[model samples]
Target: MFLGDASTLLSVLNRRLPELGLVRYVCTETSWIESVLFWTDIRVGTSEIVLLQSNITVNYIKRKSDYVHEPISRTGLESIWRKMIELEILAMAFNPYEGMMAKISPTATPFPYRADNLWKIQSYVEDTRYGEKYFDGNFERSVEIKTRVGSGNFFRNEHSFPVKPYFNGQISKIASF
Candidate 1:
């Protein structure tokens, strides 16, 4: 999943698009800094130079980031998203090898979502500038379900689910199986 300046939005996109491919890069909007805070904190000296620098004192309210200074408008944002889809540059939210999609991870690690449900990354490959190569896993995943009784919702109570390692790259060693 490609992300932008908004981490909040990036998280949401990732969550919603778990089926997407690798999260390689991020396209951010604008970058912000504590310019106002920094400018406001500056103290002018009583020396002669103070007068010369007075003209340079910034308003402190508005400042721009060095790398990204412009904020794309909502319309522009939508346009960019549309363009990305048109270009087929974006896939979907990242499904870590341990969570939903394990068959794609290089490590061939099997992720357990529940006591009986499990997912394993059979195999995968990526085409990098260097070259296409195999991928691996380094995570674990599990899902828990709980039930409780209350006033508005009275019934029984239950909770269970603990993450545990289940699969390793045994498939990796085998060239073909």
Candidate 2:
């Protein structure tokens, strides 16, 4: 459930409280919701918790999501279908931001690209070992091309803490997540 570098955490804990004998232990890769559910089950002495833990498997995935302001035309849909067929990847579109999403104020959340969105288009491209050269392998390139063709320009706002330029004279955005 610890969503960070385990070694860094261990080092800090060891420096602060060496007497506690805190050694790093690797936990199964579970989502935050799953971890909370498992913890609750364990706390209540649920009999099926052990079985659930045994079934946990770490999934490696690459996902790109973008909001659409307008509905896609028939030709646009055809283009997307053709691209998916050519690349052998999957793309899905859904409208989950109609009712409640529209009601919420834009300033209410850090996610600024929520309001006035018609639907969301998501692409799932797995980063596999064998296919690491073309198609889904080059995730950034593939996404850039596909998104440009489908939804004009992708709008991914950089949400990072501003930092001074490095010794190499290149400014880097430190990810605060």
Candidate 3:
């Protein structure tokens, strides 16, 4: 069983990791709560394993997310709704990161953008082949445009610490080698 967008990875695994004997996979469109439950079941080894095989055709899907620091006005919401209707957008998922997320210390994690972020607005467009074009008018052939614009080049511009190597005490061994 897999969640979200795992098609490419699954394909590569089926080709390269044949020794694992992965026969079939179930990819389901799940709600946030359902996704949480599914992962929880897998982590706790409570998931039921059943052998089922069938071809699964997934609909065209596009996802765009943005962090919101302030509330939208009524007029702004109306305009957003009008644009969504024009584009035939399927759904909008609003996830609040304020309560539990804000409680976590910034120094505790490598993710640095959690402190001031209030909510995450995720827009989904599904079932339409031209969904990507309609979802964001700026992209002509790819979603890379949107990513670059939103990312602010943080990974490239900012000073980042070596996470895994340093944390695992393998930096010295790696450097020596």
Task: For model 3, state the Cα shift of residue 122 in Å.
Answer: 3.0
The worst-scoring run of ten residues by lDDT in candidate 3 lies at 168-177
Q: Candidate 1 local accuracy as lDDT?
A: 0.30
For model 3, the stretches where C-alpha displacement exceeds 4 angstroms are 1-33, 36-47, 50-63, 123-177
Cα lDDT tens digits, model 2, 1-90, are: 345456865776689879877776743545665666564343333347575776432222234466888878989988877776666443
| Residue range 36-90, candidate 3, lDDT tens digits | 6444332332334421242222212234568888878889889887876776553
Could you give the C-alpha RMSD of every candidate to the true structure, in order shown? 24.5, 20.2, 19.4
Scored against the true structure, residue 61 in model 3 reaches a CA lDDT of: 26
Top lDDT: which candidate number?
Answer: 2
Which lDDT tens digits does candidate 1 get at residues 7-30? Answer: 655576678866653253644243
For candidate 2, the TM-score is: 0.39
User: Least accurate stretch of 10 residues (summed lDDT) in model 1?
Assistant: 168-177
Q: How are the candidates ranked when ordered by lDDT, highest leading?
A: 2, 3, 1
Model 3 clashing-pair count: 0
> lDDT of each prediction vs. the true structure?
0.30, 0.49, 0.47
Off by over 4 Å in 2: 1-51, 91-95, 124-177
